[model samples]
Target: MRVLITGATGYVGQAVAVALAGAGHEVHALTRDPGSDRARALEDFGVRPLRGRLADRAELSGMLAGADAVVHTAFDPHDPVGADRALFGALADVGGRRHLVYTTGCSVYGEHAHAVLTPRTPVDGGNLRARLEAELRSAGLPHTVLRPGMVHGGDARSSIVGDWFREARSSGPVHRGRRDKVWSWIHVEDLARAYTAVLRAPEEHDGRAYLLADARPVAPLAVVEAAARAAGRTDALAFAPVEDEKPVYRVFDRDEVIDSSAARDALGWTPQESDVLAALPASFRQWSAART
Candidate 1:
């Protein structure tokens, strides 16, 4: 399969690109700077980097034309909804027969009281991610939505794990909401394998959404303490509460326990790194190396 990946330089997208390439797919990545070190690194790994912007419909259409499937992972943190609208419009216009593997996040299932979330779990229709997902479903494209949990490992600098390390180094481990609020987590590499499994048979995944996370649901403070331990700051593991004014923090206050059995059963996807705390030492090393 000829696969095109958006945000190929991003932490998650880069892993997915390499995983697809390793799976023997001809992989191309959409990057803003094809001449950068990251793009060069991807080229070394057999992923061709193409210069393009997600907001550019013509560029996106042209890039979309050459691939058998598109793994849409590009996100504009500044204007996420606007960027996705453009990408989805382009996909609707030119994405004939091409399978779109759209990446959404577990936060879309906002404030759910369910002990474990599945694909069949009702999503918060008012959440921005859920609204965009609804738009994708209405666009009439051949697509699958993947709602990944809090991703860690593999260049952990770009992930929430890095935030823990940085905070631990400065002031100690900080818990944003309640210390007991649990989150579903996945390693970047395992999440990449899930993408490979889905793209291997896109038809099998079309029109369906899957939550991608490890089987274990862990408290944020526990992970933070592990990160502190890995960073040799176990003595400074005292937790502090940061006042975050963002509305998203409210969602973070709730437990995001996810059941990825749907993905495991349907796509033969199994998460190898189920215990995030056990991997914090290596993850801390990766984060430190990324800083230097």
Candidate 2:
């Protein structure tokens, strides 16, 4: 299969691109600058970088023309919803039978509290992520949605877990809310494998959504303490929660325990690194090495 991945240089997309290429698919990475160092790095792994941006309909359509499937992982933090709306429109304009593997987050379920989230869990339709999800479902395309939990691992500098390490080295690791609030976490490599599994058998995954996460849910403080231990700064642990007024920050205050049984049972996907606490020490080392 020929696959084109948007945001191929991003944290998740890069992993998915390499995984797809290793899985024996011809993978093309969409980028605004095909000659970038990140794009060149992908070449070392057999991925071809193609010049394109989400805002350019002609470029996106042209790229889609050659791909047997597309994994949409590109996101603009400044205007995520707007950028995706444009990308989805381009996909619709291309009008092919090609399969789409769309990336979304568990934030769509928005403050599920103590409830275990599944693919069938009711989404907070008013949330921006949920609205974008609904738009994709109604787009009349053969697509699969992947709602991954808080992703950790790989290029730790760009991961939220890495942020904890950075913070730990400075003032301290900061928790946004109660220290006991739980979060579902997944290793980046495991998340990439899920994308590979879905693409390998698109028929089985079409029109379905899967929540991807590890088997366990962990608290923020546990992850912070692990980072401190990894940094050999356990004696300097000074983590504390600070109140934030933003509605988006509320996600940190709530429990986001996700059930990924549907993905595991259907796609034969199993997380290789299920424990974030166990992985943080090595992850911190990698993050520290990257800085030096």
Number of the predicted model whose lDDT against the real structure is largest: 1
lDDT of 2 at 97: 84
Per-residue accuracy of model 2 over 178-239 as CA lDDT, tens digit each: 76788899999999999999988898888999999999999877887787778777574564
Candidate 2 residue 70 C-alpha distance from true site, Å: 0.4
**RMSD to the hidden true structure, all candidates:** 1.4, 1.5
lDDT of 1 at 116: 81
Q: C-alpha displacement of 110 in model 1, angstroms?
A: 2.2
Collision pairs in model 1: none
lDDT of 1: 0.87
lDDT for every model? 0.87, 0.86
Q: For each candidate, give its TM-score against the true structure.
A: 0.96, 0.95
**1-292, model 1: which lDDT tens digit per residue?**
8998998898999999999999999999999899988888898889999998888887898888878899988888988987888888887778488999999887787756777889888999998999999998898888999989899997785788988899877877766766778889999999999999998889988899999999888998788888888888857456445467676667556788888898899999899998999989998888788778
> How far off is residue 52 in model 2, in Å?
1.4
- After superposing candidate 1 on the true structure, give the runs of residues whose Cα lies further than 4 Å from its correct spot: none
